[model samples]
Target: MSQADACLRLNGVTNKNITISNNVLYCGSQLSIKATNDLTGASVYNNAVNGSISATGIQSCGTFAISNNVFINATANNFYPAAGSPLINNGANPFYQALYDYNGMSRSLATPTVGAYEYSTTNNSGCATTDNFKCGSSTASVPQYSLIS
Candidate 1:
């Protein structure tokens, strides 16, 4: 059966105080969880999954805080993506881009929008200096601030 890329997935299922950043999840045998059951104060950052994350992306959770995430299970060669694999490092609080939300303070931009939009090193004089507002086929270099000053 070829419809199991996300048979029962849950990423950063949230319980507040959450922050799942720089997203890119491409599961082909999915069963990815990042907080099941009784989730408390949650926080998942720098999230990235290539494929096959059968279990433990923070299931049966607790006070989670998984950081700098980049779990690639490329058919389970194992770089850690199973067995209570909330993707580990669950102590949250380590997602620096100057603590994001720039323009209201806390700045550190320049192509850093992986999971909550943090890409701005100032360059949007109305975008089109070769259109760095990014949107399709690229020679790269077209994304200059939309929300991260």
Candidate 2:
């Protein structure tokens, strides 16, 4: 899959503010995200893409800022940056960022890391903890796991 086959595809027809940031997309053959027809604004940054990004027909209304992102492969099953990965502490200080990470971990205001995960030496990959997760392949569907008590 190419950029046309992104993990998250956004097709904007109106003047809406679109920001695709703080994401870790392991698209395998596809791209991270594909933004099309953004009439107002399209902000794409602070991401860790295992592939690429594609944008088309972006209008000049609101500012489009894309910066401080890392492009590298993440570990499988629990999509986290590998040891000494570029995605570690290479985040963009976006005008607006998510308050928390993929596992609901509070982001550090002083030191921000690219993608959906915050840098942690002892992170559990959220495979056995937390409610939200970015711990899978972008090409595949969400798998089923039986709850264990």
Angstrom error of the Cα, residue 82, model 2: value is 1.9
lDDT, candidate 2, at 38: 45
Model 2 clash tally, residue pairs: 0
For TM-score, the strongest prediction is: 2
Candidate 2 deviant stretches above 4 angstroms: 1-4, 38-40, 57-76, 128-149
Top candidate (lDDT): 2
lDDT of 2 at 98: 63
Candidate lDDT values, in order? 0.37, 0.55
TM-score of 2: 0.60
Per-prediction backbone clash count? 10, 0
lDDT of 1 by residue, 1-149 (tens): 23444533454454556554444454444533433443444444545554434444333322223332333332332222233334332223445443543123232343343322233332222222223223322544323335546
What is candidate 2's lDDT per residue for 1-149, written digit by digit as tens?
Answer: 34448877776545555665656665667765576654335565555555665656433321223322222233334445555667667666677776667666677666676666677853545553222343333332323323359
Residue pairs with colliding backbones in model 1 are 21-115, 22-114, 22-115, 23-114, 56-85, 57-86, 58-86, 65-92, 132-142, 132-143
